[model samples]
Target: MSNPNEVKSTLKPAYDHVIVGGGVAADKAARAIREEAPDASVLIISDVSDGPLYRPGLSKDLWLKADATLEGIDLGTTETGAELLLGTTVTALDPEAHAVTTSDGQQVGYGRLLLATGAAARHIDTPDDDRIVYYRNADDYRHLRSLVSEGIRVAIVGGGYIASEIAAGLAAAGADVSVHFPDSRLLEQMFPDSITSHLAEVYESKGISLNSGFFLSSIHAGRRLTLESRSGEKVEADVVVLGLGAVPNVQLAEEAGLEMEQGGVSVDETLATSAPDVYAAGDIATFSDPILGRRRVEHMANAERSGDAAGRTMAGTRTEYRYTPLFWSDLFDDGYEALGETRTNHRIEEVWNDAHDAAVLYYLDGDVVRGVLMWNTWGAVPKAREVMQASKEGRLKVSELAGQITPGG
Candidate 1:
């Protein structure tokens, strides 16, 4: 536990590097900074009560366990001797002075600053109630777990990966789960109608209710909440969980007068923001991607890689962040690893296995392969990345890549 009074009294004049967020990106950046500049003083400040942990596990592995304590989830100590100031919020940033003001009214200067502020769960217009949860951190998981019981009705909002994973986990925990989303199918943004239908069937077989194209109209909170949809349909549940997706935490960057693009802090290929001596990474950074142009990646892999690159650059090693991100999610017996952009707008070429239980989908923009989706298949991430790169470089045609990727391969 950190004491605000003590931290303010003993604060140093300045540090070599200061990271503004305590998520995976900050953790990796601290380590990379230590490796590059051993003598540099590093300080990590975050509003999270706990230090960096495996955030993705909160929705998946943690919910499935009978006794899911937040143990063994820490990212572990860094060799950088970085001082951690947890449970503290940054109030303001001064780019010209190369300093930041915290909520405690203490200004800390830094030679190089990193804004890995990440994103927060998007809130909806719902009544205030203990049963209403906007799932984001470990605390949210603990609260939801305590409410899960046999036959407990859980109404989930949004049809993204978080809602899907939580629905599956709640069903396994003996809760009657109902998913309500405006999309016609789950993961509608990532998959086409064909893949969405298959995923819907898997959830339906597990006794989970799939209420698609139902926009939430109103919520009447009580011991049991009554939810009314736009279509005049009513559904009652013991608890309501919102997984409506995340909006990047860019207030600090915006206040500091940093450049913005694509709804996030704009950064160059090296993760350097428009402001001098300041960099942004992870969910808050719309970095210049070597392959995809300027884009913001929300997955954990991108966070780690971009943070490492930013740290190295801050430590005087100029390097470009060119790594491709691979995202994965597990739902019951089915799981997938996807490389590149998985948006459904592109033409998708799918190959099903002989058993009809597995599949691989190649996202093509004309004759070029833009992305790859491995359904119920693992360990094909590297191959998928190779195919995407080859297509981008015009070394392989979509037809040639299609024949090479099989369902099992």
Candidate 2:
């Protein structure tokens, strides 16, 4: 714990470095900075009142299923010696003055600045209903928890990981659950049709309501909110949650005159912005994907990697962001994990169904394996990502790959 009086007295006008944002990227970068520069003064600025929290696991029902004791985030002990400014929201950046203004009117100066502000959840345009909730922070989870105590009904909107996880959580908690989706399948853009079908079947078997091809039009809050769907269907529910998508929080960068494209700050392999002595990372960063060779903004894995890389660079250590993007989601009794970039041209080399409880789907472009998706198979994630990074065509030989199976297979 830091003493407010002591911290305020020793505050430097321009610290050795200053980090913006409090998500995974900001935390990782701060830790890396401490590692490389033990003597340097580092300050982390974040809008989140509760420091940096692990976002990958922050679900809608975070209070119940997860560890409630771990309230927010504490970056262990700052061994490298970094200061944290919790509950601070950065309002503006002055490049010429090398200073950042906060919402509370505190001006922070720095030799080097890092932007890892992350992204914000995309909400739907529905009439405000006391029953309709948009899960974003701890308060949202608390609100949901209060509502769930009475064993009420829930209608989750969207089809992303958050939506799926929320639906699963609500269903598991004994709430009458219904998931509204724009398409006929879940995660239509990310996963193949086969995977989506499998997911739908699993959700259905769990007794969760799966309403596909439905777009929520409005919400009338009461004991049960009335939801009008585009399909002329009305869903009455005690609670409605939106997990549609996310947009990068790049307004600060844009206001600071940093080059932005596609609603995110543009960065190179080093995660450096156009402005000198400044860098950007996390969900708000748009960089050229090494595997796909296209510009993309990946929220989860990319944030940590980019933040660490930027931190090291700012600390005068050489680093580069080499990404083999990986993401995982848990739904019902099953978990799905994807490793590496799956090309459109890649053919399905091997599809092994491990009793449907677990499975691995490998994709190949000719003899070279490009990507792999595992269901309830986390042990293979590290190896799959490693193989993908090691070779352009990763883990290509299906027979050889299958031969090295363990007891589970």
Query: How does residue 243 of candidate 2 score in lDDT?
Result: 85
TM-score, prediction 1: 0.94
User: How far off is model 1, as Cα RMSD?
Assistant: 2.5
Specify the poorest-scoring 10-residue window by lDDT in model 1. Answer: 1-10
Which pairs, if any, clash in model 2? 34-80
Which runs in model 1 stand beyond 4 Å of their true positions? 1-9, 78-80
List of clashing residue pairs for candidate 1: none
Model 2 Cα lDDT, one tens digit per residue, 94-177: 988889998878788999999888777787677766567887654566577678843678889898768888777777677888
Q: What is the C-alpha local distance difference test score of candidate 1?
A: 0.86
The digit string of per-residue lDDT tens for model 1 on 239-260 reads 9998989999999999889999
At residue 321, what lDDT does model 2 achieve?
Answer: 81
